[model samples]
Target: MGHAICEELEAHGENFIVIDKNESRTETLRDEKFDASVGDISHKDLIEKISMPPTIFVVSSDILANISFTERVRKQYPNVTIFARAADESTKEELVKKGANHVILSQEIVSNVVYDKIKKLEDSADAQKLLRVLKETEEKLAIIVHDNPDPDALASALALKYIGNGVNVESDILYGRGIGHQENRSFVNLLDIELKKIEDTDLNRYNKYAFIDTVPDANNSASVTPNIIIDHHEVTESIPDADFVLIDANCGSTAAIMTKFIRELNVDIPKEIASALLYGIRSDTQDFTRNTSPADLTAAAYLYPHVNYELLKQITSSVISVGTLNVLGDAIKNRKMRGSYLLSNVGFIRDSDTLSQAADYLLRLEGVTTAVVYGIIEDSGIYISARTKDIRVSMGEVLKEAFKDVGSAGGHNGMAAAQIPLGIFDSVKDKDSLIYLCEEAVTKRFLAVVGAEDEK
Candidate 1:
């Protein structure tokens, strides 16, 4: 149960330092990607040892630990949102009284899941509710994804389009960035998925919009009131008001939730959609290695028969485009190592996806425990992508502190991103200085995270 929650947080880009009283409780997550400490969160000495202040305090270990540990962490990190597991409503009340911001009753969750499943059995009310929303002939629905939409974002957008259109609504899937990754481009092309920049889109033309696989405040690209929201990340308190929110932290990918939502409508899972959704789950969950959920497995099982295994095989072998390779090469050439960390600069790139891939590629090196990739993107700004094998160093905290004065940047423990706008980008070459500054800024941020820099 504990590992499942940690996996969800990791998947959704929320970094956390997990504390377990019994060291063995975190054994399942050992050697896995995350910042997990074995000790007592309530212990003052142990709390002081924490390098990154937790944003979400999860107390899913035990009832007593839940109350004591959550209160302790919440008191230390006053702004942190507390999520505690409870046995009953009374327990929830007690947790809330003790300072938990969000109290999740274990029994209530079971009841709700059973209730939803039973609603499926008893009557088709759930279907009718969405069908009513979908049958609004005057409404146009645009399924939007956040900046530089990833596989999860793409898959969620597609799944939403299928359902919204099936129920008689006009829908189109939109993205804020170009699909440049080899696997992403192949998946998009093979699926015939049409993606467009969100800036060029008129959200006002469509009264109904759905945010797929992302939170609005989390990424400004999909900044709109969503009629429907679907995501599979750690729960955030400030989720925007939506007609419906299908955020199952237990699921590995939002695509899994979207696929199930579509399946309930009894529509045929198109070959293209199934393929895209499967790829989304595979990519977001790191081929089910990082954060595979039971729901993800169930949805994959349903989609497997409909997917084109042949196409998937072909996609795997698809060659990387020349443009991506150029940027990737530059990133590697500029790679610099500092102890367990490796920082690289890709002077300029066309998209954030390339920067992220560069970071991922760099982190694969044996000596690199933390990898930060930066690049300049014309007039848009400087983009930074950081990934880490260091389970202790929260990349989210590092980026947040590093870019706190410069720009916005925060995410899960292992992966995070930051961007700072440039005053001018009149020519392509002007990006060189910004890229260098971005790289240097990341280094400074690392120094802040580990400790103050000293003359070496």
Candidate 2:
């Protein structure tokens, strides 16, 4: 895997050195580009042999085993950037304890792919023209999320707010249901993140509106004519008016990318805002140890001195919001299994992040290599989040297959999220068919991608 990354980087003209257990792979890359060496990445001797300190050092191998390896590299080359990968978000969190500059996950790779594709499409004349439509309004912008909010959604939204604010363009974040999620409530109380009611936000007031962590027209989003978009999730439709789109499958959090823009502009991030933004980066990337980039690390370090630690603690440990438990209960009770996957049915939900959290916890079960959690967050909208150990089978592709006809979908290598709008089919309407359909769709897709199953 390290060789593969080195190979890919070399293709892009990066001068890197590869140290691997399989010595032959190193020689193979000699013909491609970059330098190579053989030996355990954890060995001290191999560490000394790496003379050229790379700007980006990707920890693509096992997390626990690579911790010391990354530490040694960082200790030797403090300025070098480390891009690490974790098996799960929690594992990613654990990796952060090792002081990694940045951690990326397989799931995030999907986000990168999405962004790369968008970068290509954005060059087209038609796409460029549509982006202009979003710019029609020059001074003000409005940003929206789904009905309720989660850390990823909130952080992503806040990131855009900062970006809009940086350009001296007034952006009013419009949404409701900041009511649920204790952590959310605490974050609200501590940071006072501004928001505007969707109804109150006059599209006329803002020249353009951009959506974060959401692809308009696909989910239960009230607005889809977004002129600008910055998201980490998968989407099928091209945002109609977005002049510039930064959607990537490689990044874990939009905050991870949002921080990049903040750095680029050399803007001074307020301490409180830095705290919120840092927490957003920590929470989404699981602290630069998972689903991260060199940019995320740079942003984190830049924001570290500016963050309010006490406020961050308050928000992370805040009391659960009212009715949030009921939403979680539904996710647990309906949980079942398909192969090593714990398939849970969150019948109806209010928060999309809760459904994702439930799926995240389910992956910790013994003998399970993967877990799939699904639920509806009101109306006919069914939301899904998936996790897996198979690094080869990207959940993004899996999600696209599962939600092809049901809805638009995509994700990174290990984790993916999809929302199916069954509003068209009333029979499947209020029925328990959401989970059933999800299971069937996911199963068929999984079987096709992975030839054999249950080997573990």
Candidate 3:
């Protein structure tokens, strides 16, 4: 396992040093051109020779040895991140107390993967039906990703395009509002993904329109009527009559659903496609920390070995722009709190999608369970992004009820967004007055719907 970690780190061009007491193992690693040392990691002298703040992976099978080594490293470095392997829950707890920053339980991860595979076997039947539907479509097709698309949306679109290409049905991937997330931009630019903007596209040119990761007639996608809808979000609104529709709200990410289709069809998945799908699942599931299902795990495990690890590393580590940081700073300073809820208005933002980024960051606060971040775009009106971990209330449904009368809003249960036209508040010319009115209206409406507003 230590060797595997070293190989992965080296694969991503990350500078790392491997320490082992066994001379043979150290020698083998050195022969493989890796930085290696034959010394006890628990030794203070050896630890002092190394760099500070390094991420240490303790993969020894010996539970006591692992715990002892972690404790020693914690005492010496004090700030190094340690990932220790655990045999069971008790061992995991012990390692944590001994200063393991993260406990990687092999049994738990394996059992989850096994359960996912069993469930995936059942999902394959649906994938075959989906493939037949794709084969039924003749010639040209347009795959529409949700507006301001994320990794899950974009990857699902790519998977559909791959299936379409197999059926000899030429297809083009289209997105409305363009891609704005920095990581998303890197994914597309690095992978050379071709996406046509809806504004420049003619809907009449395609024989079939399929929406991936978005529901039909939801105000968040292309204006064209879709013949097919494949999504993983809860079906809240009435859907359009389409030739094919596959929506499993229980699935963690749309990428998982599309991955099933790709694997079931037994087609060759390009390296970039596999990496994109893997990233999509990880991003949407927050690295399997939230809203993850067995199918999601199975899809991710299946794609893991085939993914371009280097590219995935690069995409995930993409740098954030100064503009996004500024928006986040404003959001932090101006945030309002009501119980577990947090709302922030980032006065003005050039890219509306930055609101989502801010919301994600704010939700990480110690006591916050829900976060809503909004910013005014010059001519685009108020763009609001909401995220919640509280399962008692669905954020998407909340947004739909709050702003549906005056704006367009709807998304998955956990993550949702709304866009209100600037015309409604056009009467207020003063920038501060416009922001205040907008914030007051949105906060009241949202709080009332969520039953979070202060009672009179």
Per-residue lDDT of 1-456 in model 1, one digit per residue for the tens?
Answer: 556666665655555677777776566556685666677655667657776452454555468767887777767776554567788888788889878766766645443343334334322434445666667637788877777777778888888787777767878887775677788777778777887677898777888877777766555576677777777765434787877666667677888877777777788888878988898888877888756877788888899999988888877778877887887899889887777677787776787788887888888988778788888777688788888767777676777777776676756667778777664333435445655666666677666676644412
Give candidate 2 regions above 4 Å deviation. Answer: 1-139, 146-149, 166-168, 175-180, 197-200, 218-224, 233-241, 321-330, 428-456
The TM-score, computed over Cα atoms with residue i paired to residue i, of candidate 2 is 0.63
- Please name the candidate that would achieve the greatest lDDT relative to the true structure: 3
Give residue 409's error in model 2 in angstroms: 2.2
True lDDT of residue 381, candidate 3: 82
Query: Could you tell me every candidate's TM-score relative to the true structure?
Result: 0.68, 0.63, 0.72
Local distance difference test scores for all models: 0.72, 0.64, 0.83
lDDT of 2 by residue, 33-114 (tens): 5566666766677766656453444454557766777677777776455666677888778667765655667666643443
Could you give candidate 3's per-residue lDDT for residues 1-456 as a string of tens digits?
676667666654556777788999889999999888787755657656766544677777777788888888898777566778889999999999999867878764443343334334445656666677678777689898876888999899998888888878788998777677799999899888899988888878887889999875564557777788999887767888887788887788999988888888788889999999999999998999878988899899899988999999999999998988999999999999999999998887888778989999999999999999998887778889999989887888899899878987877778888888899987788999988988998899999999889932
Q: What's the TM for model 1? A: 0.68
Q: Identify the candidate with maximal TM-score.
A: 3
Poorest lDDT segment (10 consecutive residues) of candidate 2:
118-127
Pairs with backbone N, CA or C atoms under 3 Å apart (clashes), candidate 3: none
